[model samples]
Target: MTQVPFGDMKAHYQQFKSDIDTAVSRVLASGHYILGPELDKFEKDFAKFVGVNYAVGCSCGTEAIYLALAAMGVGPGDEVITVAHTAVPTINAISMTGATPVFADIDPVTYVMDVNSAESKITEKTKAFVPVHLYGQMVNMEPLMKLSLKHRIPVMEDIAQATGSLFKGAMAGTIGEYGAFSFYPSKNLGAFGDGGMVVTNSKENYELLLKLRNMGQSQRYHHDIVGINSRLDEIQAAILGAQLPYVNQWNTRRREIAKRYNEGLKGLVTTPQEASYGAHVYHLYVIQTENRDEMQKYLSDKGIQCLIHYPIPGHLQKAYTFLGYKKGDLPVTEHAANHILSLPMYPELTNEQVDHVIAAIRDYCKEKNTASVATPMSAQVAGR
Candidate 1:
């Protein structure tokens, strides 16, 4: 049996071994690890790449979102609206700001935040809208932005799974007031370890972010305001900078692989839907099936590793019980959590491996004697 891992970070490292080694060596040789020249250059380059005027390096993705919200004055007595279908980190970031996280349902087809659901969740206390770009696809931002302007609420994009995605020709993170990105080892533009960035066009927010991420210091030994320590380390900065130039190439390959998967898995399961508003970067190639658990177990037995992007919606989780959300509060989000399964996805996966995985999935459907039924939305997206 051919083993297909969910993501191959070792293979990724091998592909860029020399460049990564050089970056690590350079950082170590400098002995300036925190808030140094390497971080400075990476921040500038990342901002340029995202078409933003300023970028601030942070300790991790959750902190990136927290810093952006903190800059926007989101705190206790405020409400931040986002989807419950995403990784807990998205909600965790909102919770870290001492604000209440309001839940919204997701689109049945695209599996991202449903704009209508988001708008309905807003109240006088709503201070910000965080449209998480889940599974590498950008949320439909135009209507969301309109709502933001109407309500005087800020928009912060959680681009943790969508570093290079686009929406209507605009970069994912550039459309909102602030964009938060993660460089976890498996992202589209990953680093060797934990890393993150926050991008924005507002100079006021940018300057505040700088101080906030650095313990609210106006100068050495001068504490300007209350802040937390969340600086992006120099070594991770160097690693991310070294890999920055290859993001487009990697994203293109991810799209190609997605196309192959779509063609191969068409009627056997409901594949990811690429919305007309944006290009999906395929950070994780997810599919929906009725018997998701059984399929996952079968795939594992076949040496094809599979996992769930999320099996429990945030609003229904034990930690969030205090928020008073029930199981059916977010119907679409809860449905997706039970049905979605993530396949092996990465730029380095070979054609043979992809085909083997596809073949295994097809075999599962055949053995079960039932093809997964595509929902009305899925059928429309698939043009069936």
Candidate 2:
């Protein structure tokens, strides 16, 4: 019986135990826990990696987006356009700014915001577009940027899932007005605890973010504007800094694992696809199947852990009922919610473990006679 976990953070930590421990010790000795040198260095390093002029660190990804929206002046009576199939935080961040969250359906194949659908939903009230880079694959930013310039709407990228993903040679988060990232332990660039970053090229926006994260203070105890206390702590920043150097190598391994999964599970499941315009970092090797529930149960029984990235689209959730979205409003998003399953995915996932997981899924598919039904979308599947 093979036991493969969905994500092994412990394994990840163990791989870098020495460096991480040293970083943590250094931070502990500094005695400046809140917004110290660690945070500053990590922000600079992350900004350099993403090719942004400034990167602002915050408590978590949700706040990162909220800060971006708030700083960009998204407020009451405004509407923020985003895909329905994303972490609730994406919508919550918009709503927290007292703006209406406008939902758009995702592209069935990419499971990202459908640009056309998003464009149609834009109105006079639409203030910003938040294209979630879900599952480590970038949304098509080329058209999204054009739409942003045309409609005069600022684009805030929810890059919680994509850290190193590229779009036409540019990094995923750098193309938008603001890019928000999460370092939740399961992410590709997981920190020891909750962390997030917002990046931007505009000096004006960057300065606004710095003020917003620290209660609108340009100087200590000098409140410039009403803001929230959401600074990224020094400990988490140090941990992130330690992990930062290895992100590219980890992303490469994740892609290799995804390729193997695609080849092994070709006809058994609808695997993730990399867009022609960008690279996928394989944050979670999600697959879609008609028998998602049974498949998950089968894998669980075989000691292969599997989970759903999202079982329900955000619009259909009880929290967003006021948004006026119903079940059939977004067919593609609804369909994906019912069928997507995230398999064991991480940089540390071994070939043997990946093979075992694939073998278990194939066994279940054979027993259930679930031949692949991914047509039109099959060409989009990575390594197909």
Candidate 3:
């Protein structure tokens, strides 16, 4: 049996080789590699895809979040609440804005930010609610919206992980004040290198973000306000545009894989659960299991790759010790940090590979059970 790789960017690239080559050729022929016609078209098309009025591409997903927050005037003396269970980039974005990232716990099931924890973290200085649509599942945004409205704070979505995902009938990015997305090569619709975008309904905020991405300048050599040079490259824009059409198709396959795992590992594994309003893109088919390490090693031995979405909770990271969070601060987030495992999930993953992963997990659990049985005899002998 051929080894199943963790992420196969090479396969997707080969599949779209002609399109990618053409995209690159067009950019090279145009002689305009920065923000140009192709970038504009991609931004507009992506905005339409997300049911938003505008989408501004940037250097990467991390920059996308920081630019959106900065455009919203989130800075020192302000607080942005988000999940502690996400990638470090989300927390880093908040810190970049000079704002304190007030963390919230996760819903034990969805593994996204808990809205109740967000509510409790709100303070007078809270300026925005940045909910992470972690692992392509939307945070229960209805209650999050209510909390935002009550506190009069904006919700900037860190949709870095969810590309084709939907929150309710509306698309993921459109539900919040600003939705930030990533186009890293591994994402559903990724770019050659790092790239990102911000989507929104408000033309005013959209304009601000555009200016911020380009050194706060509306036009070349005409600087209006303080900004950063974080524009998306024209070449990446062309590449992403070609892949956009296939995003939904890939997401569907991911969902099918998720369903297969849910049924196949019903008794042994705890698979992801979808909220009624959520249309999951399944960016990472993460499972909650107590034997995460053992399962990981078991799968590794079978030549199946597995990874942890996050091994360390954000609060425990040395960078944020000053936040005054201890090991047990947020029980749910901390506990989950130890148990989460990301199985190989992608559109191209085959049925045989999926079965191999499942079989390895079941076999590992059975062996452990048998081991504990033998341990009792050793214990009794020691006592005598």
lDDT by candidate, in order shown? 0.91, 0.90, 0.87
Q: Which ten residues in a row have the lowest lDDT in candidate 1?
A: 375-384
Put down candidate 3 lDDT per residue, 265-375, tens digits, no spaces.
876767787888889889999887766787788788888888998999888899999999988787777767888889999898988888888777778878876321111
Q: Candidate 1 — which pairs collide?
A: none
lDDT ranking from best candidate downward: 1, 2, 3
For all predictions, the C-alpha RMSD in Å is 2.1, 2.5, 6.0
**On residues 1-384, what C-alpha lDDT tens digit does candidate 1 reach at each position?**
799998888899999999999999999999899999999999999999999999999989999999999999999999999988998999999999999999878888888988988999999999999999999999999999999999899899999999889999999888999999999889999877788999999999999999999899989889998989999999999999999999999999999999999999989998998999999999999998898999999999999999998998899889999999997787777778888899998999998899998999899888889897445343333211
Give the alpha carbon lDDT tens digit for every residue of 153-260 in model 2.
999999999999999889988899899999999998988889999999999999999999999999999999989999999999999999898999999999999999
Candidate closer to the true structure by lDDT (higher is better), 2 or 3: 2
lDDT of model 3, residue 350: 89
Q: Give the candidates in order of TM-score, highest first.
A: 1, 2, 3
Which runs of model 3 end up more than 4 angstroms from their true locations?
Answer: 370-384
Residue clash pairs of candidate 2: none
At residue 143, what lDDT does model 3 achieve?
A: 92
- The top-ranked prediction according to TM-score is 1
TM-score of each: 0.97, 0.97, 0.95
Q: Where in model 1 is the C-alpha error above 4 Å?
A: 374-384
